[model samples]
Target: MSYLDPAIAVIDPVAAAGPYGREGTAIGFRVICVLTQEYRTPYVTQTFDPADFSEVYQHSCIDETVAFLKSRSVVAVVPGAPPSLKIVDVLAESLGLIGNPTESLEARRNKRVMKEYWTRHEVPCAAFHESGDLESVISWADGRGYPVVLKPNASVGGVHVFVCANRQEVVDAFNVIVSRADPYHQQFSTVLAEEYLDGDEYFMDLAHTGGGEAMPVAFAKYEKIQRNGNASIYKNMFSLPLDDPIALAALPYVRSVNDALGVRYGINDTEFKMTSRGPRVVEVNNRLPGASVPLMIQRCSGLNVFQENIRIFVDGRRTSGDYHFERHYNICCLINDQPGVVQGYAGLDEVRELLSYDGERMIAPQGVHWPVTRDLDGCWGLIRLVHEDREQLSRDAEAVHAMMRLLVA
Candidate 1:
């Protein structure tokens, strides 16, 4: 093995004050997170902007990141379409980075382009519309009619995402989204309108790295606890198996997407909903698996995906086979999303008392703000219970949650 010292930086606009940001820097990679906004951390913060210098963010932030590393710089970058590719472009221009090219970023970010790409690859996916104008968007929505999904081209963490059921709802949502986008852009307030998917939705960890091949790492299914048509929280995340043929749904698209997007390194999380016909592609992200789930994968597999992720960024190694261990069961139980003050919690102590492994935590403070919204708070408290027996693993999750109750003041 070649001894190496790879300097890495993970640039995230949303995760500055996030737990992932806090924990990520400590693990391994020499991470320098450029914040679009301030984030909570004891680590030194470097401030930067995507709005500066006609794509200066592209060269300075992303391209310059690799340059500054002065080594094999691997940025744990987040991927998106054209508007969101500020970081992706930097990686694309860099010296030993893995990511999609600007052209592929366009095809992947815009839902319509994504559908076309999938179709070209013979990959099964729901039909979608990529329109930028209010008229075209409304027409597309009217055609899909009731129970359709509408989202913006450049956004993350499920920001302002809605599941509309009628023309009124979609039109209203389009109007609302229009207000959020930059009106001066070439296309003003354009959005993707797609057919609503029924049945279970699975998040696949799909990405292609060195040697130019796709690798499927982790899978997670969410039980969305919604209130009044709003997703208040994501509860009971179940880790899935990659070996299953059906679970490999996104693997087929990896090659096409990578070849199209020119993705070199980092992670790609693709979400596809299972329908009566089959699995249809939803969207693909060109970055690491978001915060909570990656931690959940670590808890169950004892693989420390976060740690392994850091290693890849700093070392250019793909597989975590070096530190292999027997995999076990793992689950992340989110605290209920209801507004209240920090009073007290129940069963937390009991679960802690029964802990057999570590990756477990309760991030919420006793008197801090309780989650009134889904995106604001990640997990009120997480129950990462790992066990060998699937039955015992299931029971442990139940018992741990049974042990937890928040006394919202």
Candidate 2:
């Protein structure tokens, strides 16, 4: 089914735009960016108390998504409705945009199910427990020993994930869980008390190689700076040397999980810890790396995850074999130490000058709220410096981070 012109059917709603931009990589065939009146402003429509369902009902903005896509005059369709798999599934089925049936994605979003699948496959990860009674959480972690991590399930962006050192801290974490107004949302938050493996934290971005394979693309080891019980400020560098050992240790686990889950599309961020034994899997995300990963890859390796992703989607072919990735430098100077609305930013002029020297992407805006976290979380944006020289990558990373500051009011 070839179109006379290269166009893609896209969900143009405002809410789904960011994903559409990321998903656009799949539209190597020309993309018509779209916005649905319904899907575009769903966050607003979602507020109206509808009669059919719970206090919160999923409002299907597909028709609006369709109208918007049609307006763009795309060659065909490329949807980014991860949240509404149902809508995208139907649209894909009717229009022949999606590769697999919707059933393929069911297991992709759930962590508990993924854990079970991994366990059956003998894949390695943090030891975890599931219980309603909060008191048992301490025993779960204590049994594993100190420095345990408790994560609220079904969450991204490190929300409600707590690292506890002792029994009392575990109790406090449990109390916080029991007190959540949205306990159901916390189902994954069901207190995954696990042995916290402390070591180098490596961030890996994986794309599905069209024919059902998890392909490793880019990886970085992030140094976390913690303040006030969460990762507040931080730095990240491209993982080249670090990529080797972890790639060897973690690839089998990544491949097996993809096989077990039957995921075929989209990008993912899988965070792992370098344990004394080897690299250990912590959590996997179904979306693209949130920060400057897309831009960073372009600056360093001359590879664009977006372009590669788009090529795969448009062609519906294999993408994840093996490839050589040149190294580049990227570091996020997060406003993690202070908790307040961001008033302004510093070092843009100097950073721009720095980028002029090194050739990296500078992505950040002032007068926005930037919150802090305990781990690698909440980026104000990042500074990219790219050179063939890995040593230069490190040297520039240190020099630039020292120069920038985030002012939170």
Off by over 4 Å in 2: 1-106, 174-189, 212-214, 231-234, 241-245, 318-322, 355-377
Over 1-409, each residue of candidate 1 has an lDDT whose tens digit, in order, gives 1114233444543322223333444553334444332334211112123332112222345545556544444445433222334554456345545444655666655556767777786766676777667778778777767677766665454544567776677777677666663211323367777677777766777534555466667776655554433332456656666665666654565445445545555556776667787666667766555535665566655655544554554444665432222444455555565678768777766777664434555556677767554431345666665555656666777776666777787
Q: Which ranges of candidate 1 are over 4 A from the true structure?
A: 1-6, 13-29, 39-85, 91-99, 108-113, 119-122, 130-136, 175-188, 248-250, 253-260, 310-316, 319-325, 333-337, 353-359, 371-379, 399-403
Each candidate: what lDDT? 0.54, 0.55
User: Superposing all C-alpha atoms, what RMSD in Å does each candidate have to the true structure?
Assistant: 6.4, 6.9
TM-score of each: 0.73, 0.73
lDDT of 2 by residue, 1-409 (tens): 1345456644321221243443443433444443222332222122122221111112346565555545544434444333433354455555556444556454455566657666776777667776657768766777878877766555444545577778887887766655552211323336656667767887777777556556677777776665434422456656563257767677766666566665566555677777887767776655556445666666666666655655555666545466456665655444445666666666757766653244433222355555553433355545666666767667767766776676778
CA shift at 275, candidate 1, in angstroms?
Answer: 1.9
lDDT at 280, model 2: 70
